[model samples]
Target: MRSDYKELDNEKIYLVTGAAGFIGFHLSKRLLDEGCHVIGIDNLNDYYDVNLKKARLEIINKYDKFKFFKIDLQDKEFLEEIFKEHKIDIVVNLAAQAGVRYSITNPDVYIQSNIVGFLNILEVCRHYKVEHLVYASSSSVYGMNEVMPFSVHHNVDHPISLYAATKKSNELMAHTYSHLYNLPTTGLRFFTVYGPWGRPDMALFLFTDAIMNDKPIKVFNHGKMKRDFTYIDDIVEGIVRLLNNPPKENKEWDKIKADPGTSSAPYKIYNIGNNKPVELMEYIQTIEKHLGKEAKKEYLPLQDGDVPMTYADVDDLIDDVGFKPDTSINEGISKFVEWYKEYYEV
Candidate 1:
């Protein structure tokens, strides 16, 4: 036997939706780094900043292992064409209409993208017999819950916003597919993810921009809001670790005493977060301290579709994958500031 039997190339043929977005961009880059063939698809939507999305794609396309697809998942015909072309060993569904407050004004877009679009992906995956399906779920699903650290095991039946409801619906819909088809699905319930290449709409990015430009950044809930501010690198690490480890049949799973985290079929849900909540104001101060600039402030009541605080229980993440988001907000925010100054030529 050859001694080189180990470290055989996995050679996974992967499809990544929303490959131009923040998390999608990071994940795709990591997969490309691992010598995996990655097919990246995105509509290049003008939600926040189109240039930023394009910039992310530029980095990904530099790798000979990456292929780019500029298409929307909502286009059933186009999406189906892609499925037929690629073997698609695995899929990471990251495409969706994001933002809580925006959902109130453009509810139809949320339905079209998050719900109808998700169905298209699920149907295609079922048809292709894809190996593993990983999709993004949101911490917003913890809406109106009195619990301190939101657990995947808790009942997520109550969602305050249309956005949160749609994400929660994805989990339920994914579970149904896993049950009926043995599809082996994993849903990542992401908390407040922040760091370099973050979305312009996210608080940290917006605050950094506003502070640099001497513009006022809105402080929601009078700055009383707290978040489980996970760093981007940590989130990416957790995802990559779970990519090769799809959920298997939970033999110990009890039907009589059902657990929301697992099912009789090959389906699982886990929270990916820092497991530590940070005060919103304190987070801002970290940014300010890094940038050497104070932000013009606008204190406001909590907006619709938003919660006062969100903390994630990541015990399962650590116990199962030996994973924990260990990046500190200070280090994370400082890195962001450094990137911002260089990107903007400030």
Candidate 2:
């Protein structure tokens, strides 16, 4: 039997920056499966385990359609070469210096990747006239908002961390390109995304590893935090759905009564989250249930550059993309646990 994917138009190339990272790796593999010609770029920085990133690349290299570049997004000249080579239809900028805590320690990496690197992407897209540019934003952008389920319309002026500020900056930069150059752009504010091939720095991964090794897991904020943990597969689904239907100018958009989600320009922002907040302790308990071992938890106050919780209102993503994240924490964690045991031969 044939797969659901049809052969892609060899004429069209899609550029996915940060191709080796968690989200980028998943997106690139999905595009390749659909027979899309994907041009993946990543610096392959050691911010996490390089072996894990290489593992992801190994899976993608199996598909004949993918071509990867070891180029950094900060390289402007290299950016020009790529834009000139492929008739790139879409650009998904997933590459960034991730981690809020790390951002506090090393601010330069954030500036280099998030600021300088993103600027390069914007310029490349603008100059080459790419049809669509979709970049990853984060729920951390909802910093200091007292709202339970954070809405996109709410003002995001008070960013709690440098990482959140950069994500917010990305949205603003994307909008500028959309507004000025007529670039169709969509910024995705991904919630606490966790699943197979997930980042090692994330809480779930860290907690699981520590428990198995009989090490104490750092329970931050005294285990009082909550997060709308959207599974990675759900995030990819929302992204692909939106990719098929790019954002367009809202004809009915009014200047005075502006909806922050949509704009007069061909720009949009959506919260791709589970829309259900999971408490920290409950999440750990679920992990413990899967591993059959109680975690040695060391309670700590909320670290700087961290928020108490993150809960996204995914109403816009559902209304626009026609679907929202539906994976329950139990199901998601089970899958992750299974993958963990198999991947590590535990």
Candidate 3:
């Protein structure tokens, strides 16, 4: 399906919050490479390692068309200043206090960054007349659902963690703006994303780091967890395809049935996942295969705010964008390990 907005042009400015983040950095770099003007904003918080975030910024800074802003989304005044200065055509919000477990203790940060910060973004978009707003949602929103493949069409009323709840709230908030102000919005529910320059809190990085240091890795959920680990490049591709294609009001949307994915407003949701679920044990084995070393595992029960499995139903993504995440775990792991070894000089 063609996008309702005009075709993506190099002259148009794209505002990408969390540009120093894992997904944000990659997406910004890709746009800069395509000769697009990008206004990148990131707080560079010490959520993980600030140095890594700075390193990603260094790489993106080389592009002449890319400009970086050291501002937080919570800073509404600064965000407004940016909007006034740059005629941003599109806004992709990837900045959030991520991590389900982290939200257990650091709930305030999540509220401030994800909820309050998102409100600021929406208000700015509404006033500025931005063409499209695409933000990151999570598979954790499917909490307590036992379905085989989690679909956007499924009701996600039960969110287990504060982080998931905040993401679900983002979808609702986007819908409200779309309904009331005619702001085009799309929320992408990304599965387990992993690749080079991935977040350290994620499984792929943690497992690889511990194994290389000869430390026993904590195997959560008694090593029975399953995840639809989507590669970074594939996730970026999906976002790029949908950047111009803002959601339109579903003419056939039924208020009585109330499909959670679509709305009468210009709002839509999609799950961008590999669509292939892999066992946690098998995922670890793949890392071991690439590193040529076995990891000492300590089996533990499931931690708080974690689900047993996550399998995404990307039918909407494929139907709308004509693409699906196809990168295999082996290839993705190998690439990450290669980068890990070189980055740390291991």
Candidate 4:
């Protein structure tokens, strides 16, 4: 644990929704390791794998200061019960139906989980008078923008996918609460996050699984894609830094030339991603180098809900948290491959 962890007020309790999910699990564990009290809630839906979610919970259950709840965000009554039971000072809302392609077919789940569920969270935070609310937003909200590096100041009104639209809606909703209730809110736009215990649907995990099984890996956009692949630890570190540093009212914010990233209200948004964008082929090559196996590639067209490239402008993150996600693709992939092999006994 870092000295800064000890400097934090351990009496402050954290409410982490989606606590069993990939990023959630890592973040909750980090907080627990730092001797912070954590109240974790997750429906543990089969969105990816219930067993994986359970395994994460099993680890978290080890911490004496951690409390687990198997609940859904949509169940506002149960969600509120937790807030009532625990004096949650800071709330991190990571629970959402995540996936671009899945949203194309099953749009209802996205609306229900991301929209309704997030609304519930905001309401609870408002009624409970939580100190700060930090929530997960997606880089996919950039939609069709062809900009090299996506910035928080860019216009994101045109979301290409339903999933992106829901994430955009969450930011809008959060801003409303911040404005109306004077709630302190911060939204993180995470890029391609990959590491050990990552979602099975994510690119790195899919590619690794396919290669390990001697199956063909689907190379989308004919291998012309680029992503700002961020490591999980970097993401956790960014969130931890922001936990104590809530957004303050930007007195200098101009209403005439309003910036979407900051507000006169106590609200802020930061792009938490690796500043470097990795080419799809190069990413695959790194994975291959680590696994010591060649992937059988099957070239395909760009998926409907995905952009050809995603590059994050993390200047705001560095300015705010004094940190930037600098984990290299080779190093991140190597760690993931090592964990994958050890976890599967391959």
Q: Estimated TM-score per prediction?
A: 0.96, 0.95, 0.98, 0.97
CA lDDT, candidate 1, residue 57: 93
lDDT (Cα atoms) of all candidates against the true structure: 0.90, 0.89, 0.94, 0.93
- The number of the candidate with the highest lDDT is 3
Query: Model 2, residue 138: what's the lDDT?
Result: 96
Q: Where's the lowest-lDDT run of ten residues in candidate 4?
A: 1-10
Instruction: Residues 1-346, candidate 2: write the lDDT tens digits.
Output: 1122223344567889989999999988888877788999999999999999999888997888899889988899998998898888988999999999999989989999998999999999999989889999999998899888899888888999999999999999888889999999999999999998899999889999999999999999999998899999999888887774667888999899777778999999989999899999999999999999999989999999788988889888766656779999899999989988889999
Best by TM-score: 3
Best-to-worst ranking by TM-score? 3, 4, 1, 2
Worst 10 residues of 2 by lDDT: 1-10
Query: Which 10-residue window in model 3 sums to the lowest lDDT?
Result: 1-10
The candidate, 1 or 4, that scores higher on TM-score is 4
List of clashing residue pairs for candidate 4: none
CA error at residue 77 for candidate 2, angstroms: 0.8
Q: 289-346 in candidate 4: lDDT tens per residue? A: 9999999999999999999989999888777667888889988999999999988899
Look at candidate 1 and give me any clashing residue pairs.
none
Quote model 4's TM-score.
Answer: 0.97
Residue 72 in candidate 1, Cα distance off native in Å = 0.8
Q: What's model 2's overall lDDT?
A: 0.89
Q: List the candidate 1 regions with Cα displacement exceeding 4 Å.
A: 1-9
TM-score of 3: 0.98
